[model samples]
Target: MILIADSGSSKTDWRGIDKDGNVSQFRGVGFNPYYQTPEEMATELNDEFLLKLKEEVVAIYYYGAGCSTPENKKGVATALGNLFGNAKIKIEHDLLAAARATCGHEEGIACILGTGSNSCDYNGDKITDSRPSPGFILGDEGGGTSIGKKFLQDFIHDEMPAVLKEEAADRFQLTAQVIQDNVYRKPFPGRYMASFCRFITEHTSNPYCYLLYYNAFQDFFKKHVTRYSNYDQKKVSFVGSVAFYNSDILRKAAADMQIHVHLILESPIAGLTLYHKDNL
Candidate 1:
């Protein structure tokens, strides 16, 4: 038995697997080390939930944001180890989760397009190469949160140039307080940004809304993801709700670069759970 977790800044996706296949799923609070201390992260795992598992897991595979540093990974793995007494635990960055889930034993580019966006080149055994993926602030291009931030900025500054603001206000309930709280608070911003993403999905083909994708993806490719241009694998893939649900824009971006894309899986933890079940 194995436990696989793909955690982000906003949510932690959990899966339990046996020799045959995935058997159970449990949802827990988000577990990014940059957002919380080790003790705080450990507290999110409850004893009742631990005891309720159908089987005793032999290993735990945790891939999450902010675990890129060795110290961070050590701290997180130690905390989870204390919680899951008998199971061996392995921790890797969330990009590795996307890499393993998308490319697996093959070679290719793997991307995560959720609240944040990232890309890396994977060559079977490990992540062979990558460029700096600046989160939300300087980068994180082609992500829900990035697009949301742009929408809020433009809408607030009255840059829409027409009556669309009225529809946005009616649909989003985008109050001034909502704006302030989202920016000032710590974790609240991620959720607030996601709401804007929902707004985009609701109006997928709107001409006014279409520019955001071009801006985000173009920067992503030009600044960070261009490393894949020299990669051995011509196929690129994606994993995460944002990319899976809205793949056409990503496909379009790839087409401009002449890259052939193979898959757009909604969730990577599903594949990770199976990978751990077999390899661990």
Candidate 2:
């Protein structure tokens, strides 16, 4: 059996393919080697995932956030290796998962716009170039965290339009202290911020909400996508809830920048399952 995982900042999607080519799946809270310790990740995985299949897994292909550096990759690999001692495991950065899922065997620009954001230039088989992802605090321009943080800032500062402001305030029961505590005093603050995107999506018909998404995606194109060589000429694809849910505004932003937007998927797990299935 082979297991493929697409782990983001908020959650992980796991798909297991048996010898007969049958597929089964489950979910778990996300893990990032940059944040969680190896022990913690192992504990969480052991607690959440089905234990019955532990020995059945012959291999694990894990693509995850914060696994870019060698140190990070080793940490994640060690944790998974310990869990499924019989399996051969390969740990890789989530960007490659996005690239494989979106571009497949074709050269293109692949972008991730989930709890956080990243982009890379893929030449059909490998990532030829990529911008440094400084995480949610410093970068993640087009991601859910960035947009939600911006919205919360406006909400806190009384900068949002009155109608939207009132609705958000009432709907979320948000206050300055609550927002601050979630962002500053909590763990996985990026995921907390990204959660607000659901509300934003529900209200996208509102001009203020629409512009918020537009401006965020605009920043993404300027900072990440536009920097790639001949970027506008290449096929651009996106994988993440932010890009998938707000594809209209994302496309509008891309149009303004003369970019051609191609595929958009909520998660790379489905595509990844197929990729590995074919190879296996």
lDDT of 1 by residue, 91-173 (tens): 98998998888788988888888888888888887987777766677667787778888888888888863566788888768
> Candidate 2 lDDT, tens digit per residue, 148-227?
99999999999888988888779888899999999999998898899999998989898889998999999999999999
Give the Å error, residue 126, model 2.
0.4
Colliding pairs, model 1? none
TM-score, every prediction: 0.90, 0.97
| Candidate 1 off by > 4 Å | 19-22, 161-163, 186-188, 229-233
Give me the runs in candidate 2 sitting further than 4 Å from their true place: none
lDDT of 1 at 13: 84
